[model samples]
Structures are given as structure tokens and as C-alpha cells.
Target: MLLAIDTATQAVTVAVHDGATVVAEHSTSDARRHTELLAPSIRDTLRAAGLRPRDLSAIAVGVGPGPFTGLRVGVVTARTMGLALGVPVHGVCSLDALAHGVMADGERTRFLVATDARRKEVYWAAYDVTDQGVRRSDGPDVARAADLPAHLRGLPTAGRGPLLYPDALPHALPQLDVGAGALATFAMGALRRGEELLEPQPLYLRRPDAVPQSERKPVSTA
Candidate 1:
């Protein structure tokens, strides 16, 4: 069985893929509660699937272009659990998981996936939905919503961006968050094709909002 988890957006999603199909899943949209939500969601999903951590053959996670804290929660949990269970952990770009959901719906046209970057910017990617699967036709880049290329603006779009910047992505689809079930399915296909997956780490496209002080100022008696 494969366990998949994603906390790359406002949504915290987990799934249990029992080789043939996803037998159990859980999802909750709580931007402020990823740390609190992920663990129990994983445990419940596994229990619902009638499996345990030791039963998992592999762990797949969304190493995201997302908020530092939220991404850390999922990636760290995945890596820690993988270590304890003696299983390999694979990382998928959370954007690819969003795009995979679109392609799975039989979308045959090019589209965009843009999630909020929380600094009045977006983590966006362009994909071409193919018979085989979705391929990155353009970006996995970050930019201000209004500053995105005009050509990209006109593509059919997915993710929270449409909700966040309607004027930018006018043709947005209703799919808002990357589902872990889709992430699991994507990994399953990649493993079948003998494709290498990413290391289990956060894929922050930019530096975190918080940084260590370059130097501390001396406190002097005034």
C-alpha cells in the first residue's frame, strides 16, 4: 500500500492507495490548522483502510511551492514516518498533483495551476494535458498575479489563484486544491514506469518569510 499526503495549500489531504485504487481518504481545508490536522488525518485514513504504517510499501508526499510552515508539516511527517516504517518516501511537486487532477478529468487542452504564495504572489505552472498524462509546457514559477504573461492569463486555469485573482485567471476551473489521492495516483503511475521521483523535502520556490538575523546588534547601556 502507498500512503499519500499533501499540505501544500489550504487543504490537508491524505489517502491510502492499496495498489489497485484508493481505498480510503481524508481532506480538510484549514489554512491555520495544518500542523494540528495532518497527523490525525493520516492515522484515521490508514485505520479506515484497515492498514497500519508498517503495511505501507512507500510514502508519497507533495514537496510544495507553498507556505513554509504548511509544507514543513507534511514533508516532515512523511519523512519521519517513512524512517520509522522503513519505507521510501517520494516527493511530487504539489502543482503536478493539481494538474494531475485536471488531466484525470480528461482535460485535453493546455491549462494553468496557480496557488497563493501569500505575499500577493502566486506559484504557477502551465501544463499540457496529454493522452499519456499532463506535461509541463511552461512554468513551475512564481510571479505576481497581475504580472503573469498575457499568453498564460488566457489559458484555462485551476487552483486557488482563480479565487484569489479572478482578473488574472479568468477561465479558471473549480478545482481549488491538490488532492492527496491524485498525488498517490500520480506516484503509482510513475513507479509503474520506473521513473525516479524527487527527494522527500520541501520545494519552496522562494526563501521563507522568516529568516535568521544576519547579525545581532550589541546591547549597550544608554
Candidate 2:
């Protein structure tokens, strides 16, 4: 069994996949409580599925292009559990997981998967989903929604970022809002296939929302 966790966005998703088939899954959109809620949810999902931590073959985590706090919460939890349970922890790109969620079986098409990155920018990726599964075609980049390239205009798109930023959506392709379950499913497939797992790291494509100390101005007295 493969246990997967995704706290890459506001949503917190957990799933138990027995190879390609998902035996159980749970998720909720609680941006403020990911730290407090994730562990209990994981326990409940596994208990509901009649499994234990040691029963899992591996653990998968969404190494994110997400906000720092929530992204770290998921990765840290996964790492801690992997260490305690002696299971290998695998990392999956958050955008790849979102694309997997949107893809329909046997439909070969290009797509863009996006997630909100606040400050009016988005974490985005382009993909092609064929019978073999989703393949990354373009970046997992951080870009302003209004600056989306012309080539991406004709492809199908999904995720909260695009839905939230409708002005960026072109008329040529369909758009859908997919979530974390798809991510968990996709990550499970990668783990089962013996894919090389990347080191867990936050995909912060741009600078964080903080000013440098040197850039700060000092207060003056009259």
C-alpha cells in the first residue's frame, strides 16, 4: 500500500493506494489548519481502510510550488513519518499532481495546471496526457496570470489559480478545477513504477514575500 499526502494548497489530501487503485482517500480545503489537521486525517484514513503505518509500502508527499508554511507542514510531516516508520518517502511536483487530477483516460491532449501563488502570480506547468499518463511539456514556473504565452492558449487548463484568474483563460481550450486527489493518485503511480524520487524541496520559483534588510528604510525624527 502506498500512503500519499498533499498539503500543497489550501487543500489537505491523504490517500492509501494499493498500486494503481486507490483503496481510500480523504481531503478538505482548510488553509488555516493544515498543521493541526493533517496528522489526524492521516490516522483516520488509514484506520478507515483497516491499515497501519507499517502496512504502507512507501509514503508520497507533494513537494510544492505552494505557500511556504503549508508546504513545509506537509513535507516535514511526511519526512518525520517516513523516518519513524522506516518507509521511503517520495516527492511529486504539485503541478504534476494537479494535471493528473484533470486528465481523462484515453484522451490525448495538452494541458496547463496552475495553483494560486498569491501576490497575483501563479505556479504553473504545461503537460501532455496520453495513454501512458501526464508528461510535463513546459515549466513548473511562476508567472503572472496575464502573461501566459500564446502557445498555451489552445490547451486545456485546470486548477484553482486559473479558475480564480479567468482573464488569463483563452477561449480555445476547456478549463476545469481539479484538486489533490488527482495529485495523490499520480504520485502513487510514480512510486510504484520505481521512478527516481527527487529530494524533497519547495518549488519556490520566485523570491519569497519578504524584503531584504538592506532595502528597509529607517525611521527619522524631526
Candidate 3:
């Protein structure tokens, strides 16, 4: 069994993948409650699958180019569980999860994936469906939709960016956000193929929203 979690977008998704297929999953959309929702979702999904943490052969998580707070919650939780349970944890690109979600629906051979990056920008990647799987063709960068190359903006798109900026990403697909079910399925397949997945970490494409306050000079009363 494999456990997968993804919090790379507003959605928090947890799923259990038995050897052949995903057996159970919990998914919800909440921009502010990843920390709150993730743990319970994991517990509930495991219960639904009739499995324990120790029963898992491995763990997989989405390493995101998302906001720092939400992204960190996922990576940290996965690593902590992996440590405590003595199971290997692997990372998948959160965008790739979205791409896989799209491919599964319609098998679009080529397209784009973009998620909200706040600050009027987006975290975007282009993908090509290959014999092995979805291959990231370009991007995984941050920019406004209008500022992207024309080909990218015109590609059939997935994820929240199109919802937020419709005109710029007109060919939007129905699936948005990284689905943990898809994330797990991709990781398991890769492992079966002897492919190396990423280390469990956040793929923050830019600096975080919060930063240290500028140093202030001491006030001398003398």
C-alpha cells in the first residue's frame, strides 16, 4: 500500500493506493485550512482503506510551487510520518499531479498547468504526454499569464490560473489543482518502473510571502 498527500493548491487531497489502484481518497478545497484538514484526512482515508501507517510500503507527497505556508504543511507532514513510520517518502511535482489528472480524463497529448501564485502571478508548467508519462516540456516558472510566451498561453490549460485569468488562458480544462489520487498513482507507477522520484520538499518557485522585518536602528536616549 502507498499513501499520498497533496496540498499544492487550495485543495487538500489524501489517498490510499493499493498495488493495483487507488482504493480510497479524501479531497476538499479550502485555501486556508491545509494544516487543519490534512491530518484528519490522512487518518480517515487510511481507515477507509482498512490500512495502518505501518502497512504502507511507501509514502508520496506533492512538493509544490505553491504558497509557502500550505506547501510546507504537506512536505513537513509527509517527512514526519515517514520518519515515525520508517517508510520511504517520495515527492512529486504538484503541477505534474494536475497534468496527470487532466491526462486521465481525456489524454490530451500536450497542454499547460498553472496554479495561482498570488501577487497577480501564476506558477506554470507545460507538459507533453509521452510513452512513459507526462513529460514537463517547459516552464514551472512564475509570471502573469499575459507575460508568458504565446504558445504557452494558448495551450489547453489546467488548474486555477485559468479560472482566475480566463482570457489569457482560454482553453481551460475542467480539472484544477493537484489531486493526491493522481499524485499517488504517478509515484507508484514510477517506482514500479525503477524511476527515481524527487526528495520530499517544497518546490517554492519564488521567495515566500512572509519575510523578516528590516533591521531597525537602536534609539539612543543619551
Candidate 4:
């Protein structure tokens, strides 16, 4: 079994996949409680599927282009479970998983995946879907959506960022939720191909919101 989690957005999702097929899945739009909700949800999903942590062959997590806190919650939880169970932990680009959720086979198309980054800027990337799967053609960067490459204009686009910056992607496809089942499905493919396990890490496209106090410049007293 493969256990997967995606805390890459306001959503906290978990799933159990037996190879390519999902046996169970759970997700919520509880943005503030990822730290609290992740564990119990995982347990519940596994229980619903009648499995245990040790029964999992691997843990898959969304290595995110998302807010620091929620992203860390999922990555850290996956890492802890992987260590405890002595199984490998793998990562999938959160956006790629989102694309996998909607993409169809044999469709030659380019796409831009964007997610809300919460400061009027978005985390964006471009991709090309092929027979092999989705391949990233642009960035995981923080930028104004209007600043996305001109080449991306004609391609179908998806994810929360587009909705957050509709002006930047005026002609793109309507956004859709990228759920836990997609994450698990992508991870299962990786496991089947014997890919190396990845350590969980945040895919921060830019600096964090906070700056150290010491780095703050003193206000002029004149």
C-alpha cells in the first residue's frame, strides 16, 4: 500500500493507494489545522481501508510550492511515518499531481499550473503533457500571474493560482481541486519504477514572509 498526503494548499488531503488504484482517500479545506488534522486523518483513512502504517510499502507526500506552515506539516508527518515504519518516503511536485488528476492520455497539450501564494503573487509552473506523462516546461516561481510567459497564453491552465489571478490567465481553463488520490497515484507509479526515495522539503519559490528582527533597518529619528 502507498500512503499519500498533500497539504500544499488550504486543503489537507490523505489517501491510501494499492498500486495504481486508490483504496481510500480523505481531504478537507481546513487551512489552519493541518498540524492537528493530518495524523488523525491518516489513521482514519488507513482504518477505513483496513490497513496499518507498517502495512504501507512507502509514503508519498506533496513537496510543495505553498505556505510554509501547512506544507511543513504534511512533509514532516510523512517523514516521521516513513522513519517509524522503515519504508521509503517519496515526493511529487504538488502541481504535477494536480495536472495528473485531470490530464487525459495521448493529448498533446501545454499547461501552466499555478497555486495561490497569498501575497498577490502566485507559485507558477508550465508543463507539457505527453504519452510518458506531464513534463515541467517552466517554473515553480513566485510572480504576478500577468508576468507568466507569453508562450503559456494558448495552453490550458489549472489550479488555485489562476483563480487568484484571473487577469494573468484570462483564457485558461477553469481551476479544479487536486486531491489526495492524484498524489497517491503519481507516487505509486514512482514506486513501481524503483525510483529513489526523496526526503521531504518545501519548494519555496521565494523568500519567506518573515525577516529576522536583526535584519530590520532602524527607523530614522531625525
Candidate 5:
């Protein structure tokens, strides 16, 4: 069995896959509540699947081009779970899951995966989708929403970025839902082929909002 987790955006998702099928999944979308929601969702999904942590053979996680805090929660949880179970942990690009969620097999399209990066910018990637799967063609770039259209014009798009910048992605397709199942599926396929998956590392594209104050520039009393 494979356990999948994706907290890359407002969406907090968890799933259990028995190699051939996804047994159960759970997800919630509340940007402010990732910490509070993710753990319980994992527990609930496992319960629904009638499985225990020991039943999971491996852990798959979505490493993101997402906000700093929300992305970290999923990666950390996945790593911790893998360590506890002594199982290998795999990381998939969260944007690839979003792209795969929408595109059909055997159909090819130039598509864009855009997720909210906040502060008027987007974390965006472009991919070419086919029966084989989504192949990233460009991007994973962060830019103001207004600039995206010029660079990513005329491609069908998805993710929370469009919700934040409607005009930037006018042809946006719906992809705001559970991504854990896809994350698991992607990982399972790779493992089956003996392909090495990405390390369970957070893929933050930019510096976080909070930065430490410069080493207290020696306060001097003259």
C-alpha cells in the first residue's frame, strides 16, 4: 500500500492506495487550517480504508511550488511517517498532479499549472500532456499575475492561481480538488518502473514572507 499526502496549496489531501487501486482518500481546502486539518484527514483516510500505518509500504508526497508554511507541513509529515515506518518516501511535483488531474490520456495539449503564490504573483509551470502523462515543458516560475498571460498565452490552465488572477488565466480549467490520489498514482507508477523519485523536500520557489532581523546591529549608546 502507498500513502499519499499533498498540502501544497489551501488543499490538504490524504489517500491510501493498494498499488492497483486507491482505497480511500480525504481532502479539505482551507488555507488557514493546514496544520489543524492534515493529520486528522490522514487518520480518517486510513480508517476508511480499513488499514493501519504499518500497512503502508511507502509514502508519497507532493513537493510544491507553494506557500512556505503550508508546503512544509506536508513534506515534514511525510518524512516523519516514512521514518517511523522505515519505508522509502517519494516526492512528486504538486503541479504535475494538478495537470494530470485534468488532461486525458492519449490526448495532447499545451497546458499551464498555476497555483497562488500570493502577493499578486503566481507559481506557475507549463506542461505537455499526453497518454504517457504530463511532461513539464516550461516554467515553475513565479511572477505577477499580469505578466503571466504574456508568457503563457492561449494555454488551458488550472489551480488556485486562476482563482486569484482570473484575467491572467481566462481559460482556466477546474483543478481545485483532491490531488492525493494522483500523487499516489504517480509515485506507484515510478516505483513499478524502478524509477527514482524526487526527495521529500519542500520546493518553495521564493523566499518566505518572514525573515529574521539582521543580527542586532550592535546597539550603541553614544
Candidate 6:
């Protein structure tokens, strides 16, 4: 069994996966309530799946290109759970989850995966959907919505970024949210194949909004 969690964007998703099937899952799209909502949702999902923490063989979490605080909540939970349960923890790109959500629908072979970065910029990547699964071909770059590479302008896009910058990407797709199931599925495939999972690290593409006062240079006497 696997426990999956994602709090990388406005969405808060939690799921319990029994092999390829998602046994129980819960999700809510409230950007302001990640901390308050995540633990309860995980508890509810596990209960619905009829499993306990010890039953989880591994934990898969979305390590995101997201706001600092929201992204930290998920990663920290996964790490703490892994320590408590004595199971391995796997980190996955949140963008890959968004891509998988779209690929499941058998959409175009190629498209862009993006998510809101909340500074009038987006965390974007390109994916090539294949029979094996979704493969990332290009960026996981952060750029101003209007400054996206010219080549990516018209391609099919998914995630909240398109919703935020409609004109910049006209061919936006409807499956904007990435479910925790997709995160579990992606991690399971890699584990089954004995492939190395992405390092358990948060992919915060830019420095956080909060900075330490120590990093600031003191005013020099003039």
C-alpha cells in the first residue's frame, strides 16, 4: 500500500493506493487552508481505505514548485510519517502529477505542464505523453506569464497557470488539477521498476518570499 499527498498548489490531495488502484482519496482546493486541512484529509483517507500508518509500504509526496509555506507542509508531513512508520519516502514533481492527470485522458502527445508560482510567474514544463507514461521533455522553468518562450505560446497546456494567464496560452486544457492518485501511480511505477525516485527535496524554483534578516547587509557608516 502507498500513501500519497500533495499540497503544492491551491489543491490539497491525499490518497491511499493499493497497487494501481486508488482505494481512497480526498482533495480540496483551498489555497489558504493547507495546514489545517491536510492532516485531517490524510486521516480520513486512511480510515476510508481501512489502513493504518504501519500498513503503508511507502509514502509518496509532491515536492513542488509552489509557494514556500504550502509546499513545506506536504514535504514535512511525508518526512515525519516516513520516520514514524519506518518506510521509504518518495518525492515527485508536482508538475508530473498535472501531466499524468491529462495523459490519463489520452490527450495530445505533447503539451505543456504548468502551475501557479504566485508572483505573476508560472512554473512550467513540457511533457510527451507515451504508452509507457508521461515523459518530461523540457522545462520546469519559472517565468513571467507573458514572457513564456514563444514556442510554448500555442501548445496545449494544463494546470492553474493557464487559468491565470488565459491569453498567454490559448490552447489550455480542462484538467488543471493534479490528483494525489497520479502522484502515487508515478511513484509506484518507478518503485516497481527499481528506478531511483526523485530525491526527497522541494522543487521551489525561486527563493521564498521571506528572507532572513541576517542575509541583509547592514547599513554601512558613511
| Whole-model lDDT per candidate | 0.92, 0.77, 0.92, 0.80, 0.84, 0.88
Weakest 10 consecutive residues of candidate 6 by summed lDDT = 100-109
- Per-residue lDDT, model 2, residue 115, is 76
The alpha-carbon deviation from the true structure for residue 75 of candidate 6, after best TM-score superposition, in angstroms, is 0.1
lDDT tens string, model 1, 93-199? 99999899888776567899999898989999999867777888887889998899899998888899989999988998878999999999999989989999999
Worst 10 residues of 4 by lDDT: 99-108
Per-residue error for 144 in candidate 3, Å, reads 0.7
Error of 6 at 74 (Å): 0.1
TM-score of each: 0.97, 0.86, 0.97, 0.89, 0.93, 0.94
Clashing pairs in 2: none
Task: Please name the candidate that would achieve the greatest TM-score relative to the true structure.
Answer: 1
Error of 4 at 106 (Å): 9.7
- Where in model 5 is the C-alpha error above 4 Å? 104-108, 149-151, 220-222
Instruction: Please report how far candidate 4 places residue 156 from its true position, in Å.
Output: 1.7
Tens digit of lDDT per residue, candidate 4, span 137-218?
A: 7777778777767777446677776666667676556545558998888778766778664567877777778857766688
The positional error of residue 182 in candidate 1, measured at the CA in angstroms, is 0.3
Winner on TM-score between 1 and 6 is: 1
The better candidate by lDDT, 5 or 6, is 6
In candidate 1, list every pair of residues with a backbone clash: none
Instruction: Candidate 5: give the clashing pairs.
Output: 106-131
Q: So what's the TM-score on candidate 6?
A: 0.94
How many collisions between residues are there in candidate 1? 0
Query: By summed lDDT, which 10 consecutive residues of candidate 3 come out lowest?
Result: 204-213
